[model samples]
Target: MDYIIKNEKLKLIYEPGKGAWTYHLRIPNSEHIEGKWGEIKVSGSIDDYKLESRNLALTKEGDKILSINNEIRTAINKKGGEGSNFNAYSQCSINCNFSLSVAIL
Candidate 1:
């Protein structure tokens, strides 16, 4: 199955299967990435997703994070299949400086 998460500043579509969840993030452009549409991953749940891409390495630590609606998050040294930290448009470098809008009325 698939899931979707959105807020006043971002939209996330979770695609399941393959032992991992791929999150498609849509947000406004930020200092690090051109926040149009980017893909992130989580080992098990969407609640703890990470935006990791060699094209736009958010950090060297790899354990980058993203905060969604101040609700969900990823964690540092995320081991196994759970965490509290995540990455988005800009991987996971700059502070949260992004926005999103509702597509449907």
Candidate 2:
């Protein structure tokens, strides 16, 4: 699993659990607005993410028809910490399909 950002490779570590998979992503040399930056830690479960299905709507007017676009619901999170105190940087939904494609990155 290769996670790439701006052509730079990212390091991802995976810890398998009985019900879920935990991921630790390490972004090297993350920069801040003030130029002071450090390592960024993100952790989450495989089930905590999801890809929603899109819906379409149509309307008819005599002999005409219309269509509506649907949006995808995505849940992305960035977490940090060491051991039991691991904290999530953002709100993450605990329901998603797990993929190991990005685990080896």
Candidate 3:
């Protein structure tokens, strides 16, 4: 999924998993904050979910912030099957540990 900043015309790419979701945010060129890309993990029951991620790191052009070595385990509930009222907790990490929770929906 892609999200538009609406105010800055920025496009964000998001990857979704079972009871979790990750995203790669594109930074604007104007802000000195520098552009960054990271992932997030969300877990919990279908009705409720918990999310967490690493911090964002500064990156330059063609620079990779998140890497396979930076992945981290997130706390979640164990339940939910393929298609049932069940709730299962799962674990997932991004390329790097530099990430933060954007939102939960």
- Return the top candidate by lDDT: 1
Expressed as tens digits, the lDDT of each residue in 23-98 for candidate 2 is 4333332222011112122233222453232111111221111111111112333332222211122111332211
Model 2: worst 10 consecutive residues (lDDT sum): 64-73
- The TM-scores of all predictions, comma-separated, are 0.21, 0.22, 0.23
Candidate 2 lands at a TM-score of 0.22
lDDT of each: 0.30, 0.24, 0.27
- Clash number for each model: 10, 4, 14
Off by over 4 Å in 2: 1-5, 15-21, 31-104
What value of lDDT does candidate 2 attain over all alpha carbons?
0.24
lDDT of 3 at 66: 23
Return the candidate ranking by lDDT, descending.
1, 3, 2
For model 3, how does the per-residue alpha-carbon lDDT over 8-101 read when each residue is reduced to its tens digit? 3222334455122243333333133233443333232322432233333344463322211112212222221111111212222442212222
Candidate 3 residue 76 C-alpha distance from true site, Å: 18
